[model samples]
Target: MKATTVQNTFDDITLWNKMREGDEKSFSILFKRYYDDLVSYGNSLSPDKEKVQDCVQDVFIDVWNYKEKVQSAVVVKAYLLSSVRKRIARLYQRDHIFRKSTSIDAVSFHMEFSVEHELIDDDYATKQKVLHLNNLLNNLPARQKEALYLRYHQGLAVEQIAEMLDINYQSASNLVYRALITLRKEWKGALSLITLLSSGSF
Candidate 1:
């Protein structure tokens, strides 16, 4: 078993080198090896099963496109992680935006009312705040929002999230932390609105 592990590692290193030189078959081998793991990692981030699968497929396609210029340190693992991290982040951000904007009537209603005035109507304010949270989420950069969703909503560990996205754990950690910081800063108003509504003080 130990010998098999060593051999697989050696093969991966060789395949990575070939992939950097534009070898399609090498890329394919790496894809097959990592595909299931990547999908599993993504699924750990969100309950939306289809989105997780799509993100993993997109990650592999991205690696293929950037194969010629992609350089791995020792094996393809890190490169794959980084690639998928970026892809997942973008996917979540896209999803957030679509979910927020899909309801035109809700959006129109929000736009028509004043935030301060809505505070007097508890039920209305609560609904508005929910929409506002979605709005804030939609406005974040694709990468930032995904990092936040995967970390906060999915409850995945940093290492797992990093592995799924093909990023260094530190980098993934930073993305998740930074995204939260940005959200706290940018969406505090919406959060406050929700708090008020929930407390029956709106």
Candidate 2:
């Protein structure tokens, strides 16, 4: 397998195991590989270019800072995606309400799956799933949708979602739970479609 192949499946047990052993090269490779993709993921959640960029940058820094303590990644892509999501959520809570003017809010995101690997043989299936998931997400209730986006897409915690939304932990949990349940219901006919598209399996 190629070097980039390690980044594809969360099940690629060897690469993560190497990174756990204080492997600088391993981590650097991972960071460089995912950087652009994470930025795009962040952009999809909010229209703020600076915040999205900052969010993706912070994710790499945080991962490096915690590398020693990090355990087996629960889907490395999911973990990275969630980290960027939470960072953006924090930026939102800190500035959204009080800011009179900001460039972050003016940014627009086109939810198109950017194909990083031109060589990756099957991309259409993946892109289709991403688009399908984006549409499903757009159908959720605003609060619930934001919470879910911040939590999973941005990889925020319950407390962070609460802080971002100005709600309590329980309320945030409820929103996330409700949102997942709604998606589960809404995605009834599209199970295969979703599994094919996301870094996350449906």
Best prediction by TM-score: 2
Query: What is the RMSD of candidate 2?
Result: 8.1
Candidate with best lDDT = 2
Off by over 4 Å in 1: 1-9, 98-202
Residue-level lDDT tens digits of model 1 in 86-162? 56566656666856433211111011112344444456655665567556655665555555544544445677666
Per-residue lDDT value at 160 in model 1: 65
lDDT, candidate 1, at 181 = 65
* TM-score of every candidate: 0.44, 0.50
Per-residue lDDT for 161-190 in model 2, tens only?
665555689998999887677566544332
lDDT of 1 at 116: 42
| lDDT of each candidate versus the true structure | 0.57, 0.62
Clashes of 2: 5
**Window of ten residues with lowest summed lDDT in model 2:** 193-202
Clashing pairs in 1: 80-166, 81-165, 81-166, 81-167, 82-166, 82-167, 85-165
Q: What is the lDDT of residue 195 in candidate 1?
A: 43
